[model samples]
Target: MSRTVTLALVDSAGTPLGALPSFGVPEPWWQEVGSIVDGARRRYGVEVSVLRLLTADRAAPPGGCVSYLAEVGAPPRVPLAPVTVDLAPQPRRAPWAQPGGPARSLAWAKRELDRLGRPVTGVNQQRSWNLSAIWRLDGPQGSAWLKQVPAFFRHEAAVLRWLATATPDLAPTLLAADDTGRILLDHIPGDDRYAADQAERAAIAADQHTVQRRAIGDADALVAAGVPDLRGPTLARWIRDRLAGHDTSVVADLLADLDARMDRVRACGLPDTLVHGDLHPGNVRGDGRSRTIIDWGDAFVGHPAFDILELTEGLDEIDTAPLVAAWAARWRAERPDSDPERAVDLLRPVAALRLAAVYAMFLANIEPSEHPYHRDDVPACLERAAGLA
Candidate 1:
C-alpha cells in the first residue's frame, strides 16, 4: 500500500494548530520524516513549528518550506515572533541523536558571543549536517555575523579567522573565536554573482589566489606547530570509498582516470599553499562595484594550481578559457618566477577531483534526479571536468 505523511503545527500545549495536506511516500520514509519533525518540535518546545513535510513523489512548496510562526499555544500576549529556519536533509546521520538537546555547537557560539560581549538579536539554523547557525549580533557599535562551528567545521573557522587577521581589508574582520569553534565576524552584505565582466571576475580571482597563498602559509605553520592536517589522505580515502558505492560505470571510469591524473599532478609538487577547498562562483559576491568571498568552511592546505581548477570547474556554459588565461596572466604578473604551464597542468586534476566530490556529495544529500547537476546545463561541467582529466 502507498504510504502517506501528515504535516502539522502544534502549540506549546501540544494542541494541533494546523494540519497540512498529507503527502504520499514509501511507508518507511514517511514514518522517518514524521518522526524527525515531531522530535524537533518536542525538543524545541512551543517555539518550534513544523514548516514542511517532504514526500517521495512531490516536491515541497517553496512558500511552505519552513515555518516562521511560533507554536500556537504560547502566551496570548507574547508578540508573534517570527524566525527563519532552513531544513535541508543532513549530509549524513550523526552518530548520536540528542532530541531536544542543546546543539553542541550552539554552546560554543553563545560562549563566543559572551566573550565578545555582543548581544544576539537573531539566530537561524541552517539546514546542514554540522549544526551550523547564522546569528545576528549587536556589535560594539553595529551588527556582525556570529557563526557556530561544530567539530567538523573547525578547520574552516580557523582558516577564515586566520585570513581575517592576515588580510584585514580582504576578509571580514574577525571579532572573536573560541575553543568550541564558534566564530564572530563582521557582517558584509552583497549578492552572489556568477557571471561578471572579464575585469571584475579576474580581480576577484586574483584576490582569491592571494588569500589562498596566505592560507597555505598558515597551514604549513600549523602543521609545524603539530596541528593535524585536516585534508590529508583520510579525506581523499573517504571520497574514494563513497564514490565506490555509485553505479555510474561510465562516470566511475572517468573518475578513476581523473584520480590517476590528480596523483601525478600532486607528485609534481607545485607550490603548496592554503586553498579555498571549494571555490565555486556561488561563493563569490558583489559585482564590479564590490566583491567578497564568503563561506570558508572548505579551506584546506593544498596546491594553488588545484585551487584554481576548482574555481573554474563550475562554469559549464561560459567558456573558462578566457578566465583561465586571465588567471594565468595575473599569476605570472604577481610572481614572475612561477611557471604558468605547470600550474595549469596541476590545477586540471584538482578541478576534476572537486567536481567528482561535489557531484557525489549532492547525489548523496539530494535525490539524484532533483539535483542541480542533473540539469542540462550542468552536463557541460561534467564534460569540462572530463576534458581537464
Candidate 2:
C-alpha cells in the first residue's frame, strides 16, 4: 500500500492550523511538497514551504499517512480542521506512517518512556521521519533510544530480548515495546570512533558469526519476530523484480547475467545463518572497548560472508580476501564440512550484484536533489558488481 502524508499549517503567530488530511500516494520528499505549498497559496493566499512532517502514533487523523505541520504566514481563513486536496501521485515514503507531528510524537514518546519507567530528562537529538523516526531519550538508566516503526516492520524488541538471552552485548537491551510497534532501547553511550581497522572489523565479523550461528535453530522464531529470509532464491527474485522496471542497458546486462547464473548463486555451499543485510562501518558503533551493531531493519537469514560484505566497500579483490577469511573461518569452525572458499566464490558475484541492485533501486526512486549523494557512488557500486560478474 502507498503511504499518505498529512500536513499541518502553522500561522505567523506560530499557532497550528490543523492538518491537511487528503494527499496522493507515496509521500514525497522535499521536491514533492510544491503542490502542498500551492494548496496553501490557493486556499490560504500564501506561498509556503515551512513544512514540518510527523507520523500519527496510530491511525492517521482517520486516513492520513502522517500529521504534517507547515508554517503558514498567518492563520488559515478556513476552519482549523483536516482538509482534503487531490494530487498527482508519486511513489516515495514507506508504507507506514500516521498523522502526527513533533509535538504529538514527542508526547507519545514521553508517555511510552514514562510507561517503561524511563523518564525523558532530556532529548539528545530531534526526530525526522514523519513520526516514525528514532530519537535518543536521556533517562535515569543512562540513555535510551525510542524508535517508532511501521505497523508492518515487525517487532525488533522481541528479537532484541531473544538476542539478550544469549549474546546480551551483541544487541541493545529492550526497554519497552508496545502493540503500536514503538521500541524503547537502551542507548549505547560514548564518543563515535572514526577510524576502524581490519582487525577491529574482523572481530565484528566473528561476533556476527557466533550470534548468527547460535540463532540458526530458532529461524522460525526469528522470522516470526519479523526478520526475513533473504538468502538464495529470494534475493534472486528480489533483484530481478526490482530491475524489471528499468530499461537501461547497464541494468539489462546485469539482469541477463542474474537470470542466467542465479542457479549457481543458489547452489553456493554455505550454511544459511542470521544475516545482517547491511553491515557497513556507519551501522556499527564502537567506543574502543566494545562494538554494537545497529539497524537490523535489513537483516535476513543468509550466508555468513554476506553479513560482512558491506565492509568491503572500497576494497579491491585482494583486500577483501582477509575479511572473507575471517568471516569464513568462523563459519568453518562451526561447520567443519563446509567449503568456505567455494561458498565465497559462488556468492561473490551475487553479493556484488546484490549491493549494486540495492544502490540501483535507491537511485531509481530518489529525486534529483538526492542524486548528488549517490551520483558518483552508486554507479561505482554498479561498476564493482559488473566487474565481479
Candidate 3:
C-alpha cells in the first residue's frame, strides 16, 4: 500500500506556518518518520523533524494520508502559500514528542559525545514512537545511537548496562545513560540479520544460550537492576491479572487452563533466566565475522524457551529445526535433567499469552494517537495462542 503525508509545519521557535501540500512517500508505517523528514527536505527544501502524528485518513495505522506536526529548522528556501493548519502543542504527549523534547535529547547527546571526544558531525532521526525514539549520530570516530524510552521502559539502559559487563560483545556497547531513559550507545557495525541462513541463525541462538546460562545465577541481580522478574509463577500471576474481565471465548479458554499450563512448562525443569523478551533475526546485527544483538527494551528475566520461540517467530516457511535443536542442546548440556524440548513444546501458548500481555502493557502506557500502531496486537496474540492450544 502507498502512503501520502502532509506536514503541519512549525518553525524552530514553535510558530505555526500552515500545512504543506500533500506528498507521497514510499514507506507506509506512520511511526517511521525518517522518510517523511527526508521527503520534506528533498521536495520542499525544508529540513524538518516530525514531532507527532496529527491526523490520519487510514482505516488502520501504518498507511494512507497521514498528517504530522513537524518542527522545521528554518523558513523554507522556496516559499509558497499553503492551507492554514492548527499547530497547537498537544497535551499528554510522549517525552520525545513534547515541545523541545527532541532538542533537549539532542543537546544532551552532543555534550556526552563532546565529553567523550567524539564530536558529532551529523544527526538523523531513525525512528520515533511512544515506546522509544532513536537517532543516529555520525562523527569522525564512527556512528553512535541516541535512544530514549518511556518511563515504563526505563530499565532498558540497566539491562544493557548489565549486558555490557556480562557479555560485552553480545550486545551494543552502552556509552552513557541516565535515569530518565536516555542512553548513548556505540553503534554495531553490520547489517540487520533479517535474512540470516539457518546455520547462522543456529549459531546465533547458541551464542545467546551461553549468555542465558551465565545469567542463571545472576537472575536476582538482573531483577535488582530493574529487569522485570517474569519467572513461571510471577508470569502466570501477571497474565491472570491482565486477562481478568476479558470476555472473548478464546481468552476464556486460555484463562481456564493457564495455571495448569504454566505448571507443565515449569515441570520441564528448565530454570528461569534472562530472556531477550523479543528475539528475532531482525534484532540481530552482524557481518560474517561477528554478531551483535540490539534492542533490549523488551529484555526481562524469564524462561529461556521464550527466546527460542521468539527467534523463529513469523518465519513459518523457513526450517527452524536446526535452530531449535541447537538451542535445546545447549540447555540439555547445561542441565541434563531438564526437558528443554518439552519446555519449548509446553510454552507455546504461554509465549503467546506473554506477548499479548506485553502489547497490553504498551497500549496502557502510550498516548491514544499512537495506539493504532499496536491496538490489534493483544487480540491478535490471543487468537494466535488459542490456535496453538
Candidate 4:
C-alpha cells in the first residue's frame, strides 16, 4: 500500500550480498539491511558498505518499492543472488541506472569517518540525486553532516569551504572536503526558520543579503566551484526543455507564453551575482545572533531577485511586508538605481516558470515508478507560474 525505497549490495568481485534477513516493515528493515554490510565486515573481514538506491516500483511485491544498487570490496566465496526486500523504506527516486550507484555510498561514509577517527554512533540517510548520510558521532566530537553530491553539485563543498574562510559563521564550517563532491561540516544548532518568528525571519533576510554581498567579491571562485551562471533566458530555455517532454495542451500553452517573454527574460543590464538557488526559510536556520544558511546544492550566479523571490514565496504567515521592505532596502543599498518592487514584478513570472521547469526536470531525472511523490509538484509549480502571469 505505502511506498518504499530499497538498495542492493554487491561486493567488489561483483557478487550479490543476497537479501537482508528482516521481516517487519520500514524501521527494522533498514536496520537489518544495514546489518548485511556489518555482518560481512565482522564475519569475513570484508570491507563492504556503501549503497545507493536506483529504481522504484509502486507495485513491486508487498508495496511500492524502490531498489538501490550497491558495491562491496571484493567478491565473496559464498553464493550470491538478488535480494527481494518486503519492507517500507523512506521514499526517493532512483537517480542512476548504473551498477553500484547508491549501493557504494554507505561504504564511502564508513571509510571517510574511519579516516577522520570519528567512529559513528549512528547514521541518517537521505537521497535526491546522490546521498547525504548524517553521522552522529559516538561521543566527544558530537556530530557532523556529510553530503555526497552529483557532478552538477560538485562545487558545494568548495563553496562552503570558501565561504567559511571569507564570511565566518555565515555557512557551516567545512571540516574537510574532497575533489569528488564530498564535504564534511560541523553541524550548527537551531530549528530552521521555516516557522520562525518575525524578527528571526528578518534576520535571515539580512544574513542572506550579507551573503550576496560577499558573493560578489567571490564571483570567480563561485564559478570555479561549479556553480552555474544562470540568467532569465538560460533559465527560460531549461524550463522550455523540461516542459517539452509533456504533451498536455495546458503544458503547451504554458511553454508558448513563456517563449513570448523570452526576449525580455533574457539577461538584462542588472548585475548578476551569487543567488541561493533554494533560499526558503527551511534552508535558513539559527537564532538572530547567528543565522546559518544550509544546503548550497543549488547556489548559482544569477539575478539577485531570484533569491528574493524564493524567500518571498516561503514566508507563510510571518508578515512579509516588513521583511520584504527591509530586505529590499538592503538590496537597493547594495545596488543603487535598482527598484526591488520593480525587479520582483519583472522576475515573478520568469521565476515561477523556472521553478515549474525545475519540477519537470526533477520528474525526468527520477524513475516513473517514483512519480507518486513528485508528480503533483510539477503542476503546482506550473500553477504558480500561471498565477503570477
Best by TM-score: 3
Model 4 clash tally? 21
Q: Point out where model 4 deviates above 4 Å.
A: 1-139, 247-270, 287-289, 314-318, 367-373
Clashes (candidate 2): 16
**Model 2 CA lDDT for position 258:** 62
TM-score-best of 2 and 4 = 4
Clash list (residue pairs), candidate 3: none
Tens-digit per-residue lDDT, 1-389, candidate 3: 76899887777677777777789988887778788878888888887778877778865676789888787767676664565655454454677776567888999999999999999999999788788888999999888999999887788898888888888888899889988899999988779999987787787788788789889999999999899888877888888766654434776776778788878888888888999888888889998889988888898898899998988776663476767777888888888998988888888878998888888877767777777778788889999998887
Lowest lDDT sum, 10 consecutive residues, model 3, at: 83-92
lDDT of 1: 0.51
Model 2 CA deviation exceeding 4 Å by range: 1-99, 126-132, 149-158, 179-181, 251-254, 257-262, 316-319, 359-380
**Candidate 1 versus the native: TM-score?**
0.64
TM-scores, one per candidate: 0.64, 0.69, 0.94, 0.71
Model 2 agreement with the true structure over 147-210: per-residue lDDT tens digits = 7654434445566777788688878777777676577777785543336677877777777877
Candidate 4, residues 1-389: lDDT per residue as tens digits? Answer: 33343335555544566643222224222212344344455554544443543455442233445454555555555444567533233344332223354345545655667777876676643333332333333335667666666555667776777777767778887766776566777778876778866776677778778778877777766777677767556665766777776643544555666555544433233456788788888897686567789888777877777887777785554576777778778867766766666666667767877776666766665445444545676677777766766
Off by over 4 Å in 1: 1-7, 10-111, 121-131, 138-140, 149-151, 178-181, 222-238, 252-260, 266-269, 286-290, 314-319, 333-339, 342-350, 358-388
Local lDDT at 159 for model 3: 81
Candidate 1 C-alpha lDDT tens digits along 157-250: 5666566677656666677776655677776767676666556666767888777556655767754533334343434554565455554343
What C-alpha lDDT, on a 0 to 100 scale, does residue 224 get in candidate 2? 73
Alpha carbon deviation, residue 333, candidate 4 (Å): 2.1
